[model samples]
Target: SSFPAVLTCKAAVAWGPGQPLVIEEVEVSPPQPMEIRVKVVSTSLCRSDLSAWETQAIFPRIFGHEASGVVESVGPGVTEFSEGDHVLTLFTGECKTCRHCTSGKSNMCQVLGLERKGVMHSDQKTRFSIKGKPIYHYCAVSSFSEYTVVHSGCAVKVSLAVPLEKICLLSCGVAAGLGAAWNVADISEGSTVVIYGLGTVGLSVAQGAKVRGASKIIGVDINPEKSEIAKTFGITHFVNPKECSESIQQVINRITDGGADYAFECIGDTGMITTALQSCCQGWGLTVTLGVPKVNPELTAHYGILLSGRTLRGSLFGGWKPKSDLPSLVDMYTKKEIQIDEYITHNISFEDINQAFTLMKEGKCLRCVIHL
Candidate 1:
């Protein structure tokens, strides 16, 4: 299925940190063996995208890893898929041969990390260009533009019943939040859980808890308005950290009868990380961190929290296997148990990626999806 297509695309490129992202023309190559070229129909500019933008994670970076689209081409040895397949692009790639891959935790696969670090297919170079110069791949996904390339390991086929726009959110943020509860934290039936930072990820945590039969799902955030958003997603209680900061710990303990059984730090803030860990029950609690704090990933809390059997752990990509997890999530959405459709607060075109970032920084938008 070879055809003549120059495959030109306009993508947002951040020359460096604290600088604006400018769209530039880049040529996308056709798929090679074990690779597939996808024509991204819809992509999302998420908070994590802004994190990469702020950190200058890569030079001439093509952001927007959360995306869904049609398969344009499939390279050889790719018996798993064919052209015209509806699929979702996973930023995390798995090499199956790596230790992390064989362990059944594809999210933690080393190859996924390698691909995000600008490592491309067998050629050892990026697929997109920055003014004729090759640009690095951010998290193995660069769906900000009209098209992007990926190895077969990274492309997960999904049902066509799911809308492309909604599936776009699942690329990372949605997957991470929901995955934390279902896979990482595993909130038990009728358990008490608290989630910090009421963003999309936080809301998803609350929703996951609701589906898991959590009796009291408490949400905490500095923005009081987020309480409304949290409640809509099945949060049983909401707390304003700014107003309750002094006694937030006591308030949580009082509400949960001794703190919560599971805690999630959804916002990438250091202070909230500490609060999430300390807000757990005296013992027999789990704290799962979904936030990527800018500096000092190490967290501090009273050792007694852990000494008493409180568990503090971290997970990436929501401990999801793209193939298995993506479909189950779609089923959840179809069952109306998960509400990705109602969760979206804004929708911007690819042209407004910058404004979306600005809105995210202000903590105003729950989700700002980009239509291709």
Candidate 2:
């Protein structure tokens, strides 16, 4: 029996930071042990992808992680997924055997955790190459190409009944927001929740809060235009920081009659983390930070913030173990318990990939789905 041959396919390669992606033919090697090769059907642009494309030094890389695809082939010693299985690519994978994975308290899988060096966890090597020159992968999924190879733990098998294009959002943004609200914060009914940022992730948080029966879900974003669209996702109020005369935190405190019960920092700005904390009530107030900061990773807060009984927490991928948790999210989408299609503001082709970045930077779209 012969293995699948190396595949030469179209991939959007970024040669330098802030440079437009070049669509070129690249060789995708067969999956190594504990890996799988996938035919990506749909991929979406994420803020983290944009941040990496603009700032991260890892260039000449393939940038994409939120995606849905079908398994083209499975590598040796892998039995969880088979060829032709529909799946969603996960940036942070769940190697169920790890301590954190089995603890039932964390979604961070130590073995297949976040890959920052643009290579596979099993080996510090890339599967994508152009004329024998390596092209780094973005978050291991690299769905910007027509085909990509990912560790089996980094991919979740989903039902064929779900639309590959829409369900792809669950691979990252939507799931993150939903998980932050439900798992991390455990938002209670009738509580006052304020979310800083109204991107897909923030809106998903709003939706989760609404589903949890929160009485007031306030969405804070600089863009006033997002207010109308955000209402559909359960946001009861919208605040534009630029328009407010007083501090945004003051405004939130006024509306909530002291402070909101929960505040979420979803804008990826470390500066906003403090504001989120300030907007929370004194006792039992929880602030959850979901953003990936571009710089100034260090966080500073007045000692009184903690002394006053307020808690600050961090959320990654909405506390979801991709392989073990994403399937239930897929089910929630199918049952209309969640909103995936509402977040897709634009659908573009692979050739127009750069346009998606523009829309994201300009804050013109919620999510741009790229058909591969």
Best model number under lDDT: 2
Compose the digit string of candidate 1's lDDT tens values, residues 53-131: 8875568778778889998877778888888898888877666677877787556666654354665746777888755
User: Which 10-residue window of candidate 2 scores lowest in summed lDDT?
Assistant: 1-10
Candidate 2 backbone collisions, by pair:
none
TM-score of 1: 0.94
**Residue runs of model 1 more than 4 Å from their true location after superposition:** 3-6, 121-123
Stretches off by above 4 angstroms in model 2 are none
Q: CA shift at 299, candidate 2, in angstroms?
A: 1.0
List per-candidate RMSD values in Å: 2.0, 0.7
Q: Mind giving the per-residue lDDT tens digits that candidate 2 earns over 1-372? A: 368789999999999999989999999999999999999999999999999899999879999999999999999988999999999999999889989999999998999988999999898999999999999998888999999999999999998889999999999999999999999999999999999999999999999999999999999999988999999999999999999999999999999999999999989999999999999999899999999999888898898987999999997999988888888999888888888999999999999999999999999999999999
